[model samples]
Target: MKTPGHIRAVSRRTVLKGAAAAAALQLAAPFIIKARGETPLRIGMVDPLTGAYAAVAQNEVMGARLAVQQVNANGGILGRPIELLVEDSANDVGTGVQKARKLIDRDQVTFLIGDVNSGVAQAIAQVTNEKKVLHIVSGGHTDTITGSDCKWNVYRVCNTTSMEANAVADLLFTKYGKKWHFITPDYAYGHTLQKAALADLQKLGGTMTGNELTPLGTTDFSAYLIKARAANPDVLLVLPQGSDMVNCLKQVAQFGIGKQMHVAGLQQELESLEAMPPEARVGIWMFEWYWKQPGVSGVDKFVAEIRKVNNGKVPTARHWFGYTSVHTLAAIANKEKSLDAKKLAEALGGFELADDVKLQPNKCYYRKGDHQLMTSAFVGEALSQPAGDPEDLFRVDRVVAGDKTAPPEAATGCKLQWPT
Candidate 1:
């Protein structure tokens, strides 16, 4: 039983003790913060996660997520963890631009990557350029993204339409025939791809039998297939990608179009082939990246890691695009010791990717003139049945080097204007 004065004295001592403890904590706060390390470096990724390109776009996101995990595990970007903020473009140009703005302004991301749809990718590029954010076009293959519409800050991981066309044109002409018919998607990507392919065909003295500009997200491709078969072309090019490609090829097989003509296209994805039936998976095409490269330094490890998150599915080109995009930013930023967009952009112009990151036999580097990745094109024929693994649906015929297929930098119409 203490007196009221004694209780008050005890209370005062307790309050003084708390004050001293608080001061001690204040003194240790800086050390604690230093030990905890700096805040995460944010990277914003935009893609069509819920539309025609959803499967491939989601794969891209998956690859980016893995790269983020790898980056943070190593030492992170400039000793800071990487925070990847992903937003869905929904395959719309307007939505892509809006998402890009949200990531740049509200989220304050240091870098940006996106878009399977070339139109959406270009739209996002405008926003990224205005904001001066370092951007990587992860999957979009329109020629102008790294050509006429290219910006100082925008670099592309995927091959250009011209590169793809150059890769497969000779093979198609020699193996198939001279007359070609096309069922092309009506978009920037399809348009550019068709134009480039046509240019190559003409250069090889091949004649275009017909070209049907099918709308994006078209579920029924019977009419287009009918027109293509009716043309009686030596080869029928099914040029839509992602779900669209799956749909087109499915209808082509159902209608027995492949039996009538040699079916092929320029760029094909593992995601699309997986979605397709056995009969529909007949084509000669080019893969931007393939998971089945024997003796490739990092491909096996990459495939194993991707399988962990991708439901045991092997990685497609889209995944490599996303993975390479994030790693590119991290590698350049770490090397330069700065996140300045211009510095990173300048350094990236002729930067060569490491063997592990490249995952291909060829020397992969970003071309200085156009900021386009010079990666090998996996030219192959789609298998109706799995050769070995269930997911091994493609047999690589030849791995063409980018420098061998791609035109001279002067011909690409890419005049990179660096910021002063």
Candidate 2:
């Protein structure tokens, strides 16, 4: 009941009308104050920002932030500014979950983009499923994300391990006629990748000389290199990420693998090789999402912008992946004009960005069956540039469009489905 004074001030007609309106306004004030405390769009990011894949994580963050900037510049999403909340997982599994919880409970983020490592992605997926929160994985691409553990709230924006492993492995065998041996880390990323590569190699009529799974912290590859040397395979696919890749490639010249081995995957990322000496990383083949090649959508502008931001030096390929992932988030948020996680996940199935080059219409989609994205993968070769500059070390040798690499539906073991 409002006071007589409030009733009188509210209206001439017994003041009942103004009393109700005044009471409602008083009630709304608390909600308005609380809303003001929260960010415009609660986007939580968990990544290995301080550890092995920090460079990749940083690149991904830059890309995501760029999307946020672009979206806000165009009058923001649904007329509301988006605020991205980031937390470092330090590449630790426990930290990944902890950070995710903070994002969900404290930051109140409606959606999330993730840890650079597959392990971190896996852990976060479990948490989101349990909490019924949405997770859009931009960096992690392990099969497990879309595999057995794929959850209701989880959707991936990158290819799975099975996709890359089979695609790259088969590509090498068909093109290079592989008598293959592998040098991969013993951890999940390396092992899962090696398994897929080997399977594809065998399917393509290639002989697998053998494989050696080096220890996770094996800084010195002399022993592993010695083993690889003994195998004498035509293809030497290195599956290590982060400093492991850079370190191993540096010593590969001494092992003479460069003389006879065909490098692919991580060994072929141009930025990693730019730090390497000639012959140490040349003719290296690697699979990727985008390169500054003509006809590839969004590549030239993205590359130019990144180069401009990095001051003429090129951003790491991982940076571009992060870049694309960020824009994807903004698109989903802007398309349905909602910050709600479920709506964004549903919108993801048929989503397309007018500016997205790597993802094309109809052809590009998130596999409703497994929650995996069908993104084009590029098989690139390291250019033998004398300058060995970070920006000029590699060029797209082959355009392995998404259509060429995707396996038949009967092949993948995914059981879950999404609406058309």
Which candidate leads the pack in lDDT? 1
Whole-model lDDT values for every prediction: 0.85, 0.64
* TM-score, cand. 2 vs. native: 0.83
Error of 2 at 162 (Å): 2.6
TM-score of each: 0.91, 0.83
lDDT of 2 at 186: 76
Clashing pairs in 2: 60-322, 63-323, 64-326, 297-357
Q: Write the per-residue lDDT of candidate 1 for residues 128-189, one digit (tens) a residue.
A: 99999999999999999988888999999999999999999999999999999998999999
**TM-score for candidate 1:** 0.91
lDDT of 2 by residue, 1-420 (tens): 111221123232212122222322232111111233333655677877665565566667666655555655665556655656667787778999998898888767777888778888889887877677778787786666677667767877766666676555655676566698778877667777777777777777787777778865457888877787788777777777776777787788767677776665532455456556766665445556544556656666777665544445555556656666666776767677776666677677646545463433225666655666676666656665545434566665565555466565446665654333
